[model samples]
Target: MTTHALVLKTFPAGSPRGSWPAEEFAARLREHGRGAEVVMDLVADSFLVVEAAPPPAPQDTSGHEASRLGAVA
Candidate 1:
């Protein structure tokens, strides 16, 4: 299954001095009830603070169709 993520922010790879801004940002997001995580992106050569996107709501058209058909003529 293909997974999707919502990228909240991006940061460059940290320096040797241990300045990890992406992780800090992710931590702040988590504290606010967001399931955020920091992951390294080789293709982009940077760190990404991302959250898993919720699944799309199902398209339940049966109720709508029924209601439309029940209209008084």
Candidate 2:
């Protein structure tokens, strides 16, 4: 199955004071796995949810570099 990154944002329950970093949210998602869910406490009564997906592959910079080298050659 194709993996995708997801993010959810929610408001605080009854107070206005606190926030969660994206990294923190992502960590929770990783721990939970596919069906995991989390409610983040955002600034002044706000929250967020985060999901994880297979990390993207490294970019292929070698191809571009090779092309440039060929041109120089």
Candidate 3:
């Protein structure tokens, strides 16, 4: 499971078998540049359309590199 998944929409899981409206909706979101996906919620008896969390910012390593260089000198 992802650490953070925002539920954008919820669809009842009563669609005909082999038909996935939730997935189709998620695919449209993805096409529009959204990181969206569908996940089943058995307890809720529904499909959730979720957007994935953005990745964390890269750590700054300039200070660490400078310290290492100073130690070597």
lDDT of 3: 0.85
Per-residue error at 43 for model 2, in Å? 3.0
Off by over 4 Å in 2: 1-5, 15-34, 64-73
Best by TM-score: 1
Cα deviation of 43, candidate 1, in Å? 1.0
Q: Please report how far candidate 3 places residue 12 from its true position, in Å.
A: 0.7
Clashing pairs in 3: none
Q: How close is candidate 3 to the true structure, as a TM-score?
A: 0.66
Q: Write down the worst ten-residue block by lDDT for model 3.
A: 64-73
Name the runs in model 3 displaced over 4 angstroms: 54-73
Q: Which of 1 and 3 is the better model by TM-score?
A: 1
| Tens digits of lDDT, candidate 2, 1-73 | 6646565645345543454454465566567664445555555455555456568855656555334345322
TM-scores across all candidates?
Answer: 0.72, 0.36, 0.66
**Residues 21-65, model 3: lDDT tens digits:** 999999999999999999999999999999877767566555553
Clashing residue pairs for model 2? 8-49, 10-47, 11-46, 12-45, 12-46, 42-46
Candidate 1 C-alpha lDDT tens digits along 1-73: 8788998998877545768888888998889999999988998889999999987855656555333456332
Error of 2 at 42 (Å): 3.5
Higher-lDDT candidate of 1 and 2: 1
**True-vs-predicted CA distance for residue 23, candidate 2, Å:** 19
